[model samples]
Target: MVLTAPSPKIRRSATKVALVVGSVLNLINQGAAILGPADISWVHVALNFFVPFCVSSYSAARN
Candidate 1:
């Protein structure tokens, strides 16, 4: 038996969606830093940004 790969359109759409979602998460984290509680720790906020995950997604899309 053999399986066929998804078409280019579908693959691009999926990657775009993944990138957008990752961007939204990063944006939300940044916005929280600007408008959220003053007592929030810098370390915690930095972690919330999820930079590594977003970067990995971007790299994947680029390839």
Candidate 2:
């Protein structure tokens, strides 16, 4: 099947989901770097948010 971009509304909803889920995950997975003396990996942080966003968007688009 051909893939297509999700609509703006779906994208917005996905983004919200990603923000909440990703933040919680980051807090759990990278709390030390976030709250203590450690170097934060920007790539990992971005992926944490991005993965959820993509999952949400894909699910919405599929239905």
Candidate 3:
């Protein structure tokens, strides 16, 4: 009998999906810019840092 592990390609695909979803969320946040104050743009910039930290931590905890 033999056992096999998941391949690197599968891991890379999952990472790509996460990045795409994160980018889409960022775009949605940016698209809301016109409705808020001048500083609202800062929120989108902040998410660049915030989102990855949050997602990484959450994923780490799940493992």
Best model per TM-score: 2
Worst 10 residues of 3 by lDDT: 1-10
User: Candidate 3: lDDT of 15?
Assistant: 57
Instruction: Candidate 3: give the clashing pairs.
Output: none
| Ordering by lDDT | 2, 3, 1
Backbone clash numbers for all candidates listed:
0, 0, 0
Q: Candidate 1 has what TM-score?
A: 0.34
Q: TM-score: which is higher, 1 or 2?
A: 2
TM-score for each candidate, following the candidate numbering = 0.34, 0.88, 0.36
Can you write out model 2's per-residue Cα lDDT over 1-63, one digit (the tens) per residue? 025445787889999999999999899888999889998988998999999999988888877
lDDT of each candidate versus the true structure: 0.52, 0.87, 0.54
Scored by lDDT, the top model is 2
Which residue ranges in model 1 land beyond 4 Å of their true spot? Answer: 1-5, 30-63
TM-score of 2: 0.88
* Candidate 2: regions farther than 4 A off: 1-4
* Tens-digit lDDT string for candidate 1 (1-63): 012124454456555655666557556656665677645456745554445444544555555
